[model samples]
Target: MTNRTMTRRDFGSKVITVSAAAAAASLAAPAVLGAAKARVVVIGGGAGGGTVARYVAKGSDDIAVTLINDSPTYSTCFFSNLYLGGFRSFESISHSYDTLAADYGIEVVIDRAAGLDGNGRTVTLANGDTLNYDKAVVAPGIDFKFDAIEGYGPDAVETMPHAWQAGAQAKNLKRQLLDMEDGGTFVICPPPNPFRCPPGPYERISMVAHYFKSYKPHSKIVVLDAKNKFSKQKLFEDGWARHFPDMIEWLPLDITGGVKAVDVASNTIITDDEKFQASVANVVPPQKAGQIAQDAGLADESGWCPIVPETLASLQVPNVHLVGDAIIPGDMPKSGFSANSQAKVCAQAILAELASKQAFKPRFRNTCWSLITTDDSIKVGANYEATEEKIAKIEGFVSQADESDEVRAQTAAEARAWYDAITADIFG
Candidate 1:
């Protein structure tokens, strides 16, 4: 089937169908006051939770869906680097939940989920309301380990912003970059392995370089990497060399001997071999699943939720599903695309188990695109299938360093188009 942009009319049609089916189901059931409807509570409102809630509510009238998120509006982390680079505006990435509630009949709650009782199948909201659920989906994104690097914590984010979660943090980082002196040096300390968005730090460096090349021409960027190699390294290096020559420097752990600590007040990063100072210090610390997951006993010793790959059901908690950055996805990188894909498969599985429908074969796909410059982009993508052991990668594609200019431009356009389509799919 060909993918087309969903219009307001399409959404209206879906709403009508859903309402009619729900009415019919209610009338046909013998139980009183929604006893027949299966309750599903989604514990996040970003890509994974929003998509799952929308799909479950739209696909089945017999299921009652409630989506709980802490914020009134969602700002996507996926395109935040572009906003930092001045390629996009903050308003463009922000989305509202009005449509999800009004159109899809999802009960949208703008409150933090304070606790989860898996045994009792209840979720406790911050306001002291305990809601019961037949099944729950937790898609809460990454939480930073503030103390992973000594002397670095949430209080120091103002001086050295991670901005990994987007919104105000991203804006702050952009403001810092804009205020830096012309010849100043900017430093970024990427997080260790098994964090959200594997290629994000490199993409950020590219975007920062793009900004420095245009506004602060004399400014430079230095990457203090925790890992020796990174995703799409050659493509990023080539783009940096070609577009922002001599403006970006990457230091691997082997060279810098890994970061020991950070001095936010002095704007310095301490490594074994050297102490580097910078005008801006963007330190992305190590990460774990959102705190609510850990509190709910959904996470294991690895600090990530373990799930059955085919169904996305929590290994520790029955009738609960884990998606997005919170789950251990094996070969799949923690990305919005991966989360959205996993949500669909999970929604289908939930519907099959509750609504007595046949389960569909599960297949997941993810593509991460990085903008090197304005209209210069590259991408890495893969298709996966669930095995007895894990979700295994089957086929993959990547943009090459030697690709032609036309191809790179087309790739950038594709990236922008994807952002539009995906946000619409998730938010609408």
Candidate 2:
């Protein structure tokens, strides 16, 4: 097996000979191994769905996994702020599903899920196809609450792109940012509690301010935050003072009364106490679990679906697991990293259930990175433990507020490395 002992021709001949032998064995043993594998239907092909599909398919020879999604490609919401700030391209964040299907032997269906028949244990696609499964995993992410803000709805997203989901909206927001003149104001309205990525809006402001500091030096970014305090507040504020100075300003809920209305035509956003006009406005509205989850009766009055922590199975039903932003795992922030980690736990729990073994205790981890400037970055991360009722925080975690310059820089590097590694784990 020494590398110097084999020539290219000999290697090629040996590969062909091995392939022929395997083919002959498969053909001869047809009756012994021709049974169809057990089917696992996964809905939504974002971080959670893709990871579970790949892991389950690769983990077992008796399981066949099918992933259903609305789009062929997915764009990362995590790094999209960089694109909006003109630091990265769309292709850098976009990923395809081909690798999951081809390399892992998972069947990826590019179609929307119209509904779920929980009782029948089947998922109905938009095209009227029904897929039955022994177990189903749903990770449909977040859905916007159009009526949460007066005079704001789906139609308004065209001009005031939330840019939260990262796709066309992200591109549109970037265009608006570029179209603005120097010294112009950019207004960003962050949603209330329990939204996807708690620190996302602050990070966005930091990144956008980074852009303004370099190009439109006189420009200002005003954050109309609905919450009194946000994730990584002290770190973000320190970063702003050290980096952007007066370029970025934040108005808490009490000061701004929260963004109540937007006059799209005049490019003005009205809060309860004041009215502000801007060259560009980014309004991230209140959110709920994706529509599919709501339609399946998985969501409660609070707009989030509750699940049993250890199994991630819906509290309302059995055998249906909910992961990612869709599930209300207590104390867990809704982020892609959270989703990916939870999906693995769900997969292991499902395998245990199938084998009639005690389900493994679930542990989770999440790390979120924000680019403060071209050079500096901030991050918050934690580990979680699951009980019968809720997912609680465990030890071995760090926050940006606790980091020194060297630690922050090291974390920034880890952030980029993590992005590459996780995307590879999802798509590759």
Write model 2 residue lDDT over 69-187, tens digit each, in one string.
88888998988988877777899999988788778877787888899888876788887777766578988999999998888889999988898898899989998988899999999
Instruction: Supply the TM-score for candidate 2.
Output: 0.89
Q: How well does model 2 score by local distance difference test?
A: 0.81
Over the stretch 47-116, how does candidate 1's per-residue lDDT look in tens digits? 9999999988988888878899888899999999999999999999899888898899888888898998
* TM-score (all chains, Cα) for each model: 0.92, 0.89
Per-model CA lDDT versus the true structure = 0.87, 0.81
Pairs with backbone N, CA or C atoms under 3 Å apart (clashes), candidate 1: none
In candidate 2, where is summed lDDT lowest over 10 consecutive residues? 1-10
